[model samples]
Target: MAVPLLSVAAPAPHLIGDKAYDADSLRYWLAERQIKAVIPSTASRRTPYPLNRRIYRRRNVIERLFCRLKNWRRIATRYDRHASNYLARVALAATVAEWIK
Candidate 1:
């Protein structure tokens, strides 16, 4: 999923992800694209890769934003069946959340 999406997306300097994205292949893929992978290594790995804890910490904010967005019942339950409507509702919810913040 990440591979196809990234292939078409604009290049970025860094790719931030959790432990689930710590596969060697993905790391190599990102390195090939010159994008730094800020993913934390999984515990079972024999040699964990070095990570920039400071950069990885930023992912928490995005996670929290999604958590807040899910507070809207419509988005959490996926009430909008259409992709366009769902996107619009998400935008609206994000706007509202920001306004209330």
Candidate 2:
């Protein structure tokens, strides 16, 4: 999913994710692509890496955006079957939300 996005858009230097994305293979893959993973280690990890708290705080904005989007039933339920259509709806929702804000 991210690979296609990176191909279409400018490649990001850092990838921020929640602890659910904190897997060794994913981290290795991000490192191989020269992208820094800003994901915190899961509790079960033997050696937890230190995270920049300031940078991690920025993730809250993204989380809130998703929360707002989910408030729309069509998006939350994924009414669009096609990827393009789904993405379009998400873009529309985000634009409206930003405009209203």
Candidate 3:
């Protein structure tokens, strides 16, 4: 994700990800290119980190997407063995949910 997004977007950019991507090497890499990181500090972080509350609030959208996906029994159970079949089912579910919304 970092490589592809960075490749297309110009001048390097601020990246927002959960604590999973928060690592010393990743921070240094982003800083090297002048990307303002809004990543939050994990409990294991040794140094204090500053983050924007407004940006963090957007994370709820991803949580909602997950909850929406979980509504599909096939997805929740991983019943499909093929990737394309699974993706198609997910797309169908997402489309119907959007229509209802």
Each model's lDDT: 0.91, 0.85, 0.80
lDDT (tens digit, per residue) of candidate 3 on 63-97: 77778888888889989999999999988888886
How well does candidate 3 score on lDDT at residue 44? Answer: 85
Q: What TM value does model 3 have?
A: 0.68
Per-residue accuracy of model 1 over 15-66 as CA lDDT, tens digit each: 9999888888898999999999999899999998999999989998889889
Give Cα distance to truth, residue 59, candidate 3, Å.
1.1
Among all windows of ten consecutive residues in candidate 2, which has the lowest summed lDDT? 1-10
Clash tally for model 1: 0
Candidate 2, backbone clash total: 0
The predicted structure with the larger lDDT, 1 or 3, is 1
Top TM-score prediction, candidate number: 1
Between the candidate structures 2 and 3, which one is better when assessed by lDDT?
A: 2
Candidate 1 segments exceeding 4 Å error: none
Ranking by lDDT: 1, 2, 3
Q: Which residue pairs in model 3 clash with each other?
A: none
lDDT of 2 at 30: 79
- Return the top candidate by lDDT: 1
